[model samples]
Target: MHGPPDARSLNRRAAIKVGVALAGGIPRLGALSTDAPLQEPARLKARPGDPTLKAFAGRQQINTDGAQALAWVPESVKRDVASPLVLFLHGALRRPEIYLEQHISMADETGTIVLAPFSTIGTWDAIRGAFGRDIGVIDASLRWVFERWRIDPRRIVISGFSDGGSYGLSVGVANGDFFTRIVAWSPGFMIPVKTIGKPPVLISHGTEDQILPIDRTSRQIVPALRAAGYTVDYREFKGPHAIQKPILEEMIRELAGRR
Candidate 1:
């Protein structure tokens, strides 16, 4: 589990701040060059396979080529029945095991299957530079789950926290044709490599977040997305760089069309 903000994690956050500073207060979005692997054609090929059998119940490990990944299938989801899928990305210096159960619990309540995949390194590949190795890992995990369960193409979601959240906003938008919705918790900045579709976004940030200040982060991001013609639901709460469970629960329900 994520014990506390360690020195390495803090340094990573500091480096993120430096990057934002270097980019004139707002980190640049989209690919830096055409040659960059921002448009990974192969990684986008995974789609839900025909389910002959039901998905495995409860939490289980998924083979993502040595990269740790996990999936949670609720009992409410059955074979051949279209189920919602969430591809959850983790924060810096963290693993999927730390927060997979949280998503699992939520999945149980929402009847959604959650797939949490750890980055190839400390954080997402796009956060360090451009979308690279991690996209393959994610694609492999998605394929593993998709081959077992019939997923509803309309409810596919990409979500994350901190660095993961930032990457989610970027990648989710870039691959919007695949993901219908995006949930970002305390995201710092986005670096989208061209948006494919206009997927609705749900973003929540803590007012007192020191790691990624709400002022320069979500406050700015929400409007930018809105101005860009993407539907955005932004929520700001009184707290730190942490999630408020009730808000997430409500938003997830809304995303599921439960509310």
Candidate 2:
């Protein structure tokens, strides 16, 4: 007689089932055409029942392997006014949905348009560049959002946590012309750039983050930005490698006020 399945075995089976279901529904964009420039969505139509007027409702096929999509919390609170856009990247665990949920309250309060893009791969690599078709996919997605929405280009902000945080620094600092503000939490050092366009950056690190040392950030990343003439706000928190709700709220408020 077969005994009951163990918890770990049951979980593995469930994970496999979920993966298979997702794979069947979404086509992989890997090994697809790289010659064509990614296209942006033509219009920004109001999505119904979007609490924040921002819905993560668009899908794009970057290549043949698979497509990545994002949900947006559009600036619905102040219908008459156009608000700044905030693009948030998720950590290596690849939980974009969770990230959006965590920040939904803040986004709604500030009338900020939140864009959280899903990485097809587990982690995003800004140093070596996005693998397979991710580069095209990401570029297309960003352009689509900017063009589709009546966004204030000068007020764009990019933020992330953990691995995503490192990406925020890499992308935000390199493309400073595109984004005005950046928030990086529990980030590792991104590949150094010879010159970075100046932008306001808030780097928050936890003292007990063993995964990515706080000292490395204080010693290397912060100094590099300062030396590059970028305005940096570095904060050290007394915690582990997790985002503190209070600090995150304050940062969001400060950024929203600037716009």
Best by TM-score: 1
- Candidate 1 lDDT, tens digit per residue, 1-259? 2223521256665756645653544546433223446555323668876865345788878775665688888989888678888888888886677667666667788888888987888788877777787888888788888878888888888889888888888888778789888899888888846667788899988898777778888887887788777899888888887766886677557656632
Model number with the top lDDT: 1
Error of 1 at 165 (Å): 0.5
Please write out the lDDT profile of model 2 over residues 73-127, one tens digit for every residue. Answer: 5446343345666777777656677666667677777766676776667667542
Error of 1 at 88 (Å): 0.6
Worst 10 residues of 2 by lDDT: 1-10
Q: What are the lDDT figures for the candidates, one per model?
A: 0.75, 0.58
